[model samples]
Target: MPHTISGFSKLSKSEKIEWLLNTYFTDKDSARALVKQYWNTDDKLQKLHDEFIENTITNYYLPLGVAPNFLINKTIYTIPMAIEESSVVAAASKAAKFWLDRGGFKAEVLSTEKIGQVHFIYKGGFDKLEAFFKNVKPKLISDTASITKNMERRGGGILDIQLRNKSEDLPNYYQLHATFETLDAMGANFINTCLEQFATTFKNEALLFKDFTGDESNISIVMSILSNYVPQCLVRAEVSCKIEDLKSKDIPNPEEFAEKFKQAVSIAEVEPYRAVTHNKGIMNGIDAVVLATGNDFRAVEAGVHAYAAKDGTYSSLTHCSITDGIFKFWIVIPLALGTVGGLTSLHPLVKFSMEMLQKPTAKDLMKIVSVAGLAQNFGAVKSLTTTGIQEGHMKMHLMNILNQFEAADTEKVTLIEHFKTNIVTHSSVVEAITKIRESGNFK
Candidate 1:
């Protein structure tokens, strides 16, 4: 069994690796060689990567790709995507190209509001608590003046504060609900700092309130944190064209295709099972951009999924419709993103991605991300309703299958050509490669 050691993080890199190998591995030498093999040869870059997180080991990389020809808000852009999935970039690129000629995509930000809360318990009269809150509200705002000064200069700061009573739901539970406008920053730290200050001020003032007699004045703070749910931080992106223009060589009947697409979205809107997978396809695009830009994809994912189920049942994030000879597809999602803070300033690739995006503001980034999701959903729904998702997905996955079988360059070339007309499956590709090797074909 492995044993814990003190000062593990304080150890040098080599020492940490040595301790790890000795603690767990029988073949320490070979394991040590394998770990060192992934280290960057450039010392400075490797050092930078090592310092990015705690207990550093080595860098793990994902492919950073670009999908071109994305036209949003009348401007063309090439989006950077960092992902390991086989077909995500391809699917997004195809969708972008498809809509590029059909009026492109229109995107707009609906709002930019974020939230945080301070939960506490006070077994006090509700009316008295309300009066006390009103008395102290100005102090709560004034106490955080220093914290909000810079944000205020940038035209973004505390927006509102409210006292919410939830004693009926949970015994003596109350919350100080706060909202903020962080401008270009995600502002989790700012919101959290303000919340903690508010909590402190609330507790301090409660002890001095003359009306509170006993435990009513003894407020116990539960927690103070920023909420990942930002329903108002929403952006909308859509693509629309005349129904007649929806005709394609693969899908020749524009009217029928449009109807099928609408029905497909309708089913996802009502069915939880389909909605989960359906929204995941949208996130495959959204998350790629979010990760590439150094924003928190995990938070975006949580908030978006919650928004999808906001109506009591999980539903599709993307919607489609047809009216008066026009076919339309769109998605509106809540995304609390930043362009000026966190990894955006530290990560080299993140900085490059922001530059490539023409240094968009926070609102601009929201619109671009929304468009990515809409484009991705278009690609998925188009494939699902017509040729089936596997045809394109497996074709894109063929190279991975070939690499798994350890096919040589020449063999891979021939197989690529052969699979162009043939179906691609793990078993079929393996069997074909075996036959080619057995026949003494081009080595």
Candidate 2:
């Protein structure tokens, strides 16, 4: 019974919601009520949220949890994470506390370079195209002076541009590959603007170039955009301590634990299947911080995963080693983040998250974010090598299962105490709940 609607975007927010309810829902009143319940109580704040995106709708909420005791570079921090998944915040906190006494994490930024490209089809000889590009490269830089002026003042702007011929892969395909130094901002708009200008200037100059033939003069601009695969914008974070100092409740056998942890990382390095999940654990921390701070998690994910496979095979982003009596765990990742632009200045929670971190610049944010990923990976690998992943994960997931079964307050209290000494699983919890209900054990 689906049908198309006209001028959907032009409709008012209420009108759009009405159309959606009428078109899709069997229980329209319930659906409408549920949507309205999530809206902000303050009308002005609600209006702000609505204007953030098209087809203004109710806000989706996530728990904004903070993991404390992260001692990165001799300074303590409590990192904010906005994610729905259970156990992530707990794991990060546990890892941070564990490392707090073990010399803490050290982090540094390696680079801050971002990339963009002007992909086009030039039906011309390579030599002629090369000559035309060389002649137009300076113009490409100069023509974007208006756009680059402010960025240049902030110590970030266009770095270099080169002609890339892709004739072997496809006929008459080429690129104006460019690199940029976009200091603090993610600079998507800035990079894209520069690339479009480059494309325009290149194409316009090609038309006047005596080297290009009649067909070669027509440079077909396919697209101009920024690349999310920023391998050069990297940061490294590490934690190291003596092997004996690693002994704790979870890791009683420090030597064995160190070897096992290293072996787990090694397996992930060679096994694609294991590497994907291993890196996902790392992202649980990275993406949480990224989202909480109003940066692009998707871009970070794409870039990190690509960096993992940059060696021709997908491998672990983290590495572990034990030399002499010292145990070291580390991760180096590409994170093109910002703190002054985009959502950092707009969203209320984003501003709070930024302030909570003492208002870090892009490089400082990179170091902190990298430390988060490393801390998360360490916690995951430690759990995987010792008690296994499910025990802690299932314990954290117990409340969700309880809510799904709709257990009463008293039932929850009793069952929680009982499960403290017993195994936790869906069927077992359900069975226990059934027994309590059938026995009428309410005191």
Candidate 3:
């Protein structure tokens, strides 16, 4: 069911927040039931909620406004995201909706597992360690599988393993990477746990081998580091629209928009500053999905920026172009997010938001996430080239800024709404605030 509608000017601040609050947690019994189903104790629930309140970077409760029309892989998803920018949400939603009037956005995802790195510090030769690990690859794979047994039973676990030796001048000189399929789970903690298991398994097993290092105490470094370059779960979204549906004001030939977009990317490839802004727009959509679903936005940002420079120049993560009437968009990001672990499960609304998305594998979820980014990119360029981003963005922003001064109180908001139609000018707003000040209404 759609949430009950409210005029933006009329909603109380507390009431607005109520929309984002997990409905399951609003009642003590429902929260308790949910907590018990996943958590071991009531204490854990308290800690989760406390972390959600104090630690999670809440984005001021902006609705992860829906795009209204996105049909991907026979599944219809109205993508949800929480972002403060106005045109990003507004343009994407409207543009998507317009396309939906024709056939709808067709989207797909590649896969959903993440890869983490295991670094080992040793004084020995990396070549020797590399050969040793190569011989033990089967054992290492089996050993890692044993750790994620529960996950495998549920159709997820260690999917594959690859080994590499870095000869850097470091104490613990060996590095091993294990790729695991976590299904709907994020797999960070699980992958890290497996790394620990491997560390101990190798050390104990090493003692049994003749060629093993004699220095026991020297095996002092073993840590699992999360890698952002997790092979991407790809997402693709395309909208086929009739020329009549597009406004020439937005683009003379909507079909040409795609060609222009393709050419625009060449500029991004050549210019570092434009590349930064372009990638930032992509992140704007991606980070919101990560946040709304309770994934690590910071790490996602780090990985994306790092990936942008992979070609030696900071460039856009996605590419866009229009051949004819068809517009094509694609984004490849190392989006290794889990739906059922850590903050994603701990946050009150995270689970609910996932449910709203109708549940998807982490990799498939990344596909959805990437499409939203493409939509955001298109929407961004559309506004910049058309209405100018500020006109629409500041209109919404001013409302928020204005509320900060006078809409803090319900009566004041009621006054603002009651008179919104009449108070169109800055001077009118000033006059009303002045009148309220003279009347001591703010008090």
Score every model by TM-score: 0.97, 0.98, 0.74
Worst 10 residues of 3 by lDDT: 52-61
lDDT of 3 by residue, 1-443 (tens): 56555574355533444543544246755544443454324666555554554332122345656555666556677777777765566666766655555565566555565677777776666566666666666776677666778998998777666666565555446666767777777777787888777777666665565565667325544676657676554345555454444545556765555555567776777789988988787787777777788888887788778878887878877665554554555666667777777877667667777877887767667777877777777676666655566656555455555565654475466455645445334555556666676784534
lDDT per residue for candidate 1 within 1-443, as digits (tens), equals 34989899899999999999988999998998888889999999789889888888777889999999999989999999999998999999998888888889999999999999999999879999999999999999999999999999999999999999898999999999999999999999999999999999999999999999988889999999999999999999999999999877867999999999999999999999999999999999999999999999999999999999999999999998898999999899999999988989988899999999999999999998999888888899899999999989999999999888888999998988888998888888888899888994524
The TM-score obtained by model 3 is: 0.74
User: Model 2, stretches more than 4 Å misplaced?
Assistant: 440-443
Best by TM-score: 2
Q: Residue 293, candidate 1: how far off, in angstroms?
A: 0.2
Q: How much is 21 displaced in model 1, in angstroms?
A: 1.8
Question: Which stretches in model 3 have alpha-carbon errors above 4 Å?
Answer: 1-48, 51-67, 168-172, 212-222, 240-249, 252-259, 324-326, 343-346, 407-443
**Model 3 lDDT vs. the true structure?**
0.65
Error of 1 at 363 (Å): 0.6
